[model samples]
Target: MVDDVADSVGSVRPNCSRSWSNSGSFDLRFASDANGKYPSKIDFHQIGAGFGGHFWFAHTRKPGAMGGKMKVTGTWTLDHERTGPMKIMAALPDHGAHTEIANYRVNATRGPGGRVTKQPGDGVRWVSIGTYMFDGVVPKVTLSSETPYGTGENDIAFDAMAFIPIDGQYHEHTVEADALFDENQNIDTAAPESWLNESPLESRERLYNWAMTMSDKILSMKNCDSEVGDCLTPHVGAAVANWRSEVMAAGKDPINHPDGNSISSWIGFANSYKDRPDSYTRPDSFDDDSRFKIRTKATTTFVSDENGKIVPGSQSASYANRTADTHLPHFVLELFRAISEDYKISLPDLGYRAKDLNEHNGEYTSVDPLRSGIIPGRAYSYGGQAPKLTTYTGSGEQRGATCVAVRTVAGGSIGYRTLLSKEGPTTAMSDFSDTLSNSQYVAQSVWELVENIREMFFDSGSFPVVESSLYNVAPPIWQDLNFRACTNETVRKVDGYPILRASWMPDHYLYHNGTAMDQSGALRKTSLPLMRGDFENFSTATIEVAHEYTPYGQCRAYVEDNSFARNKNPWGINPVPRPGFNPSSVQFCSDPDLAPDPEYSSYDVS
Candidate 1:
């Protein structure tokens, strides 16, 4: 048999070999304080300067100037620090140096001579950007720069890529400088605000909406079959059918369609119908006089106390008796009635016999008079009750006696009495035989009713006798019907015959006898891995259930005629095992003539 199928589909596999990139750039500005010290003499004539082994922008004249260059001077300091966590020990002193450079644009006009000039058409503009580094003790500015030319006169810009370390790796962001001005050549701080607002960040709502639309489209196109007339025509049909089967197999319900209106209203409606009450009509009675009833009898043992008062002992037995009155029998009868009504069949009540009891006395003589001179014994009969009800009373105060009584009420009731004895005392009562026997009779009557109803619905010949063996009961016989000997063919052809064996494995047997131990001493291991390996080797093992028919000429039939024997021998059966038997091995067959060539076997050989 194939391995049990999984109850639900597994999680969707994800693509492992895919990659993507996120790229963007931002513009920023810088600010600095004036009066900062310059390390070297300023060169206002040139457009660049070398300060502390780093390049810096110097003020210069605009194009079309004749001889003199512009001179712009400004002092600035840079501040920088890393954000987020760092692996450095807090106990140790932190020493790091960071630097920022300012870009300045010079607004000036040259003079006639080849000498430098100082002029400010727009007030000197300064914006800083650069890098800083630090040792274990204190931070120091590593690189700093400022634009030498003022805005509009000559555009001066500062550009740097900031590297931020994440997960022990650095991600770099390209930063560019944009000079913002207001008619004058001063730096504007609001230049950074617009760049910050346009930062690269994903929107969660857009992603959700896209996923929803894709899922709906996938569901819509799942199993579209438009050609076949009787097949599920639409893709949605196949998808829903497959989904419903999966949900049912997993012991779950399908997801309900969302309401076009408010979800709360739909939820409320669903909750209202979750556990709606069921309506059942009252059951009919088997007999008009019969009624359902419960009868209980409590038997208590008492011991004499020191004060001569009877005290109840813990050792006592309570018997609860229930009789089939109109309710229970009516319920049973009503089940058949309902089945009959639903199937549009008629059922007739089969007659039943009442409870019966009888007794016969016998006499025997012995040699010893005191021990057993004459022995009197009674044999109880199993038949209907006698006309007159009788009650027996004991002659001695403490003597043993037997009492038998039957309740004739439509609904049975409990009748109990206390017996007291001074020496040896015992009491015997028998009434449940009738009650239990009546219950069985009622059950059989219901069965007969169902049988008749079934006969009405199905073809007369098709409705078999429904052998009691199907229910593990003895075959029933009708007193007026003739008994026929069952032929072996008839007995073997019967269907649905229940075997008289244990249906469930006993706990002890299952734990000990049924469990198989592996080489590692682990119990209850399946041979799935071994079987899978075997299949992988041969590449011919079947993975699904399928059918193959053997021609009638290729098979043989055995016959047996001894119906009375428990284990009969079939004619034409061989006693010895068949040829090529291997108890501990799996067999694989291959015909050389039918097999493909080895070279082409690996390619499209199915």
Candidate 2:
């Protein structure tokens, strides 16, 4: 839903989730980029690269700046990060606060360390402030920057808001015990918190699932009979990119020299951005104003002034679909940030400098083709172990039992991590866990790679496809605890639960060219690793779900079960955190015990 709800209070939809059906579908997405709509130009304060790169910052302290106001003219209101692909891309500045509609105050900031706070949440999802009755009107709810904080003392974030219609009856779960844990499944405390960290198990789950999905994507798609979008990836080039990144990061790039054919203008990124569009101008369908427009191409940059307001910088349409961080699409650049942030996996934990991720022919090998592990290179390829889209394995000639290089590139040794104490041992130990790093980077790298190859399939009239796309997987609703792989072949779980009996790994492998060959996946492997790759390809994937169903939903007792949400300010309400007085036998939700559907069969990943 929404990220920083700001000095006012955080407002998010109670039932919203980052993982949902129809996630990657094209939709009415409002990009939260600055449009320079604010009245004054105060010095803008920089926050982390959040929704739409950064959010709008303002303060009531400025003589003429009291903060901005947003009017949502609808029956109900909600906010979403729009961290996915969009059909309608209107740049809206995202951040800050609001005064009221139902007037529910929320936990607006991370205790002290993190910038954004979660009210009823993991903070990543849009948690609801509260659902209240509102008359059908032009301005259903108006949010203002004004807060109880002393003038100029607090800075308000003016960010994007989403307006939605809700059913007449909807409420949040209130079982004291069920609502007790933070996203980490821990009891709440006054202790300062780090909003960025997630339960390690959850992170590991995501990391593993991501790996299975990445490899499946590479292997599942057949070389298009007629070359439709270059079979959805640029495998060889990705490998080359990693290779180059390794060489370059160590200040040993051979391509950017006087004699070599060059692609590197920089060490990490390829200056391969090509022909651009003249301008991007489309009507903002969401905006009733006849003149408002949207641009799918790029968002503009703004610099803050003295009063926390911003002024437009020299940025233009070139930024369309490009993220400020990597100048890459959202799927690769921003999504990388999201996977790491949402799941709270650190790079060090994952092992990725990733300079090699986008290179032309960069690659790092894992000891076992299918099992995930890091081989010796410069340790550059962020998306290491991800199979190349155009894996020229069989296309080359090989001489060894396993794939071997026919001609080893010269400079690879100069900047290689192997050149250090790690030298001579060409590959890494077989450890499938490292596959997470491969999947994380491949998740992003493959998107644009596929897009570009498709264009080469046809012909791009203008700029490349740049978009922030969101992808997620969850167990089928109504069958909450019946999680399983398509068959017991791919997924191995505890009886009727989310626990994995063993770590899953991919079994599929690619054959290499004669004389010189490279292999992917493994023949020794019998079952595919937790096939989490649920895209157009039907690869098996595992969604590690750990739910605590404490029967928190509406109890069957009807009106006698009215919960604390309606208890004005609820903090003083009684019978909370599951006092011993309440029996554990109480039933809740449309179902209790999270019973599994007897006939469920699909392990859907979407």
Alpha-carbon lDDT, every model: 0.18, 0.21
Counting only residues 3 or more apart in sequence or on different chains, how many pairs clash (N, Cα, C under 3 Å) in candidate 2? 61
The deviation in Å at residue 91 for candidate 1 is 99
Model 2: per-residue Cα lDDT at residue 257: 36
Write the residue-wise lDDT of candidate 2 on 1-606 in tens digits. Answer: 232323233224343333322112111111121564533343334454334343444443322233332211111123323221111111122333221111222121111110111111112223222222233322122333333221443344433333233322211110000000001111111111111122111222332233344435544554434343324234433443443443234232222333221222222122121211111211122122111111011111111223322122111111010001112221233323433443344422222222211111122222321112222222110000101011122222211111111100000101112211221221121111133334543343344433432221112122211110011110110001111111011211213222111001101111111011111111222211111111111111221132111112222211222332111110111112211111112111212233222111001100
lDDT by residue (tens digit), candidate 1, 123-231: 2221111111122221111211222122222222222122221122111111000000001111111222212222110112222233233334334432323332122
Candidate number achieving the greatest TM-score relative to the actual structure: 2
Candidate 1 stretches greater than 4 Å from native: 1-297, 301-303, 307-345, 356-466, 469-606
Give me the displacement of residue 248 in model 2, in angstroms: 93
Q: What is the lDDT of residue 561 in candidate 2?
A: 28
Off by over 4 Å in 2: 1-40, 43-48, 60-125, 169-606
What's each prediction's TM-score? 0.13, 0.17
Q: Which 10-residue window of candidate 2 scores lowest in summed lDDT? A: 173-182
